[model samples]
Structure formats: structure tokens, C-alpha cells
Target: MTSPLNTLPALEKTLQEVEILLAEAEGFDEDRKKLVVLNKAAFLLLVGKFEAYIENLVEEFVFAINSLELRAAHVPERLLAEHSVQIVKNVKDHLNNGKLEKVNSMFIDLSRYWAEIEPCNSLNISNKFSYGKHGEKELIKMFKRCGIESIFDEIVLYDPQEKYDSNEDSVLDIKGIFNSITNMRNNILHQDETPTLTVGNVKYYKNILVQLAECLEELLQKIISNADSKRQKEGMFDYVI
Candidate 1:
């Protein structure tokens, strides 16, 4: 499948051009113009990337939900529709009958699972060799491409501002998590002498990756569930009735 993110090379190129233009500007007036260009470039990047992120998540949801439906059995095709309808109607009842809080809270907790893996600000692993030199960007890219981006979308949707209940367990802040991941990638690229694979460092990165994978899987599952529910609610049930 073609990644939505693949279509943004042109925008990225525009950003690069703007950056170059900003750098070449001289004098206070030109500097102000550069700032505007910089802001516009930033907005364009965020909008393009974030929209792709959501679209990718929706794609994953559709795949998972359809797979599950195909695997389930019913006496007749109409029976399948009826069952799906009941499930969605029940879900809506629960949502209106004081269960929305619990549902939202459950999603929030699932998102928090990613926090179990503490991301290191810098991998102090093996000071002699940089992880980037070892092709760590490939690893990071694999992580996101594999599903981290979708997971990130769920995390954001669950906690748009990172807010939570007063007693809620602290999870990895989305910004912090994203920054740490990016930092690790950068460190690898720059061949920074990070902490070598000491006990703490090894466990940290391993846990981080593991938590990321688990979180992503859970988010994908929830997205699938939501999609299934939406389909059932949208008059797919009428066929059975």
C-alpha cells in the first residue's frame, strides 16, 4: 500500500527552499519576513504529516476490522449483520448510560502502556560507535512505519492535551516521547558517544522499543473496534431487519 506520507516530498522540498530563503535574508525587515516563512513552513509540515498520520490509522482500522469480520461465522449473512447491529447498539447504550468515562479511561490507560518503556534522552550505549552509524535511522523509520505513527495518533486522540484524572498514573508525555525518539535517531546519525550497552542503557532502549510496539498494537486494536462499531451503527443492520 502506498503510504500517505510518501506524497509530501514536494512540501518538504518547499520547506527546504523556505529555510534557504530565510538564511539568505539580510536586515531587520528581511529577518521578519524570514520568521513568517519559517512559521508557514512549520505549519505546512505539521498539517501534512498529521493528516497522513490519521489517514494511515484509519486504514489500519479498516484492515483489522474487516479481517475479524471475515473470520467470524454466522448462520446466514443477515445474521451477521444483526449481531453486528446489536453489538453496536449495546455499545451506544453503554456510552450514554454512564460508560463513556470508563471507555475513554480505558483507552487512556492503553495509551499509557507505552510509557512503561522509558526512552533514554541519549543512548549512552557503546561510546566508541554511534548507533546512527549502525543505521539507527533505519530502525527508527521501521518503528514508525511499522505502526508507531498510528499508535501516536491514538495516544493523541485519547489525550489531546496530555490531561488526565487527578489520580491517573503518569504516562510518557507524547511530546517527550516523540522528542526522545527523535533524539535517539539524531544521536545515531551524529555518531554521538552515548552510554554504551551498560545494564541501564540496554534495558532502557529495549523496554522503549517493546513498549512502543505493544502500545501500537493496542491502539490499532481499539481503532479496529471503533471502526467496526461505526459500520454497524451506519444502517448495515437494516439489511438484517
Candidate 2:
């Protein structure tokens, strides 16, 4: 069956292909020295792709929340007020008459304003939420600021105390995992590091990525489902002519 996480199928397939390629590379004797070098390059490429997928997932989640909140409340003043004084004033100016056309125009202006001030879109997720940065605290702050913190906390799976291994008793530090992944990606891209990767390392990283993706998928599904139920309970349609 397809995974509940929509992105998992593609990612899993790619990872499996990488594993096969690595295994084949290992079969070559030392006489074929380039095989090992090629395997390393492939490993780095896999890491790069994994990092990009994570960032894209984060962007999608933030955008979905922002869109839902905007729709549930059509008044741009309330949404943009906290972000920027000028934008609030502009929204007020366009919406002064309160005509349908005026409201529509104000919405257009507000969209531009929101695009400019969106926290996640304006900054890299790592820079915005990494340990030294806001970390989990910043994530909560942003969600609360957007008025979705309650639902976010309810749905997001961020257990800092989770264990990665039962036999070795290795605890999974969520913050450290995020920071380490971000650092590795940055080091590879900026420092041109050819980091060695064994099969064991690939398996471990794959597990981490899978868990992260599943959490994000679950969060997104729950948020949307809850929003739809609320609208239904209130006897509201998605849009009105």
C-alpha cells in the first residue's frame, strides 16, 4: 500500500535505488578505485535531495496553515496588523468604504503584504528554527503568532525524549537531529566536503527522514481535517458567491 505520507513513495524509491547502487559499488575490487569515489558522490547527492525535500515539506506546511487562517478570517486587517503597521494602514485605506470591490482590492494588497512578512518564507527554516536560533521555542512562537499554535502543538510530533535505539538505548534528541542534518547539508554544499557514508549510516539517515516526513504528513492532514469539520459544524460553505 502507498504510505499515508504522500512524499514517502518517491523518497523511499530513490533511497532504495541509492542503496542498490552503493551495494554494487562495494562489489568492485580496489582495482576499480573510481567505483568507491562514485559511491561517495551518490551518497552526497542523496543527502542533498533529502535536505531539499525536508525544506520543501516545511514550506508547504507553513503555507497551508497561512492559507487556511487567511480563508477562515477574510479580514486582512486582523491578520496583517501584527506583522506591519504600514500594511495595516494600507489595508484600512483600501477597505475604508467596505464595498465588495474595495474588500477584494484590500485582499490583494494584503496578499502582497503577507508574502513579504511570512516568517518561514522570508527566512531559511534552519536559520529560523535551529537550536542557536529560536529552535522549538521559535516554532511555537510563530504558530501562536499565526493563531494556530493550539492545533499545531496538538498535531506535530516533536518528542525530544524519543529513543532512536532500544538495545543501545540511544535517545533521539529532536533539536540535535535537526541541527546536525542542517549542518551536514551546509557543510557539504559550502565546504565541498566528501563525507564518507557506510551502508549503516544511510539506513539510519533514511529512518530519520521517514519519521520526519510521516510527522509532517500527519500534521497537515489533521489540520485540514479539523478545519473542514469546523466549517461543517458552523454550517458554512468554503466560498460564497
Candidate 3:
């Protein structure tokens, strides 16, 4: 049977591969020969893979959200109202165009219209939700989008002694961590400096990425569990005779 937890193992395996590549590249970097170009190439490969991993994690997160039977009630009223208006306009246009030759045909068209608009509206809402730019401030915004910002109140992951200083009492500086990774990735892609990569730097960022993947996994699991619990409480699985 397939499991949603498969992402964790995939992430772990990718990280292992990155570690091996980095180790080999480090050996080349130490040799200081013409073949040191291999080290630069490996660094580029690592950056590309790491970026892909982050993007895939986000895609999985969006997929998990879409898979859940989340209530549309939580969606903003203004957005829903906008879609409702568009739907009404569509029906009005259909009716005004004098295409209602058959009542049955009109009803069928209406059903099709509703079917088309529902998924579009859901997708629009999902697209509006962002993980934010790679930074601490942006990360806080992302947490708000996830509706788990309050969890930071009790469990501080960034600093234990520093008092929560955000406008909204937040204990975790996850944004900073992500921002650092993003900056390193950008440098690798845009900078012309050759052979600046070190095994230490690669390992450091690799560890951070691993931490991020695990955190995202936990968050996705929590969302699935909460949705399942809610469904169970609602007796959504109850057999109807």
C-alpha cells in the first residue's frame, strides 16, 4: 500500500546522495589540480538538487492540503463572493443569449458551469496561500497562512533565552534559517566566484535542509491527522442504509 510518509524516506535518500557527492567534491578540492572543476560542478549540482527538494516539499504540502476534505467555510468571504458573482454572471449570459431553446439543455449547461467553477475557485484559494520569501519575517507569514502560528507561543525552536519579540509573540526564527539557505542557493547560481564551496558549507546547509524537510513532514502529518479526526467526529464514514 502507498503511504503519504514516503516523502520522508525520499528526502532522506536525496540528502544521503548529496552528502556522498559533497564528500567526493571535497576530496577534489583538497587535491588542487586541474580536475578541481569537478568540485565546482558538484557544488552546482548540489544547489540545483537542494532547490528542487525545497520546491518539491512545497508542492507536496499543497497536495496534502488539497487532498483533505477541508471546509470551504474557512475561505475568505470576499473571494467566495467574487467567484459567486462570476458564476451568476455566467448563468446570466447564458440565459440572455437566447440559447435556452430547451429547458433540459439549460439545466445541463448550468450543472456544467457549476462543476467548472468549483475547482477553479478552490485552486484560486490555494494559489493565494504562499510559503513566503525565504526569511524569518516571511516564514512568520507562512506560519500564519498554515494557521499554526500560535503553536510557536509554547514551543520556541530558534532561541530559548531570547524573549519573543515579534509583533505577534513568536518564539521560532525559522524564517532566518530558510533565508540563509535561500541566500546560499542564490549565491551559487548567480555568483561567478569559482571554488568557493567547502565541504563544511555543504554539510551545514545539508543539515539545515534535512531539518526543514523533517519540520515540513511533521506539519503535513498534523494537518492530515487533524482532518481525519474532524471527519471521524462528523461520522463522515457512517454507513447509510
Each prediction's Cα lDDT score? Answer: 0.38, 0.50, 0.50
Q: List the residue pairs that clash in candidate 3.
A: 135-175, 136-175
- Clashes by residue pair, model 1: 124-194, 124-195, 124-196, 125-195, 125-196, 126-196, 132-188
Superposed model 2: Cα runs more than 4 Å off: 1-5, 28-36, 55-170, 237-241
TM-score of each: 0.31, 0.54, 0.56
- Model 3 ranges off by over 4 Å: 1-4, 33-43, 73-174, 194-196, 237-241
> In order, how many clashes per candidate?
7, 0, 2
Model 2 per-residue lDDT tens digits across residues 80-154: 354444444556766666665866754655465445322212211221234333234544443343334433335
Minimal lDDT window, size 10, model 2: 118-127
lDDT by residue for model 1 (115-191), tens: 32221111111112233232333333333432333334455322323457643454555546545545544453355
Model 2: pairs clashing at backbone N, Cα or C within 3 Å: none
> Native-vs-model 1 lDDT?
0.38
lDDT of 1 at 238: 19
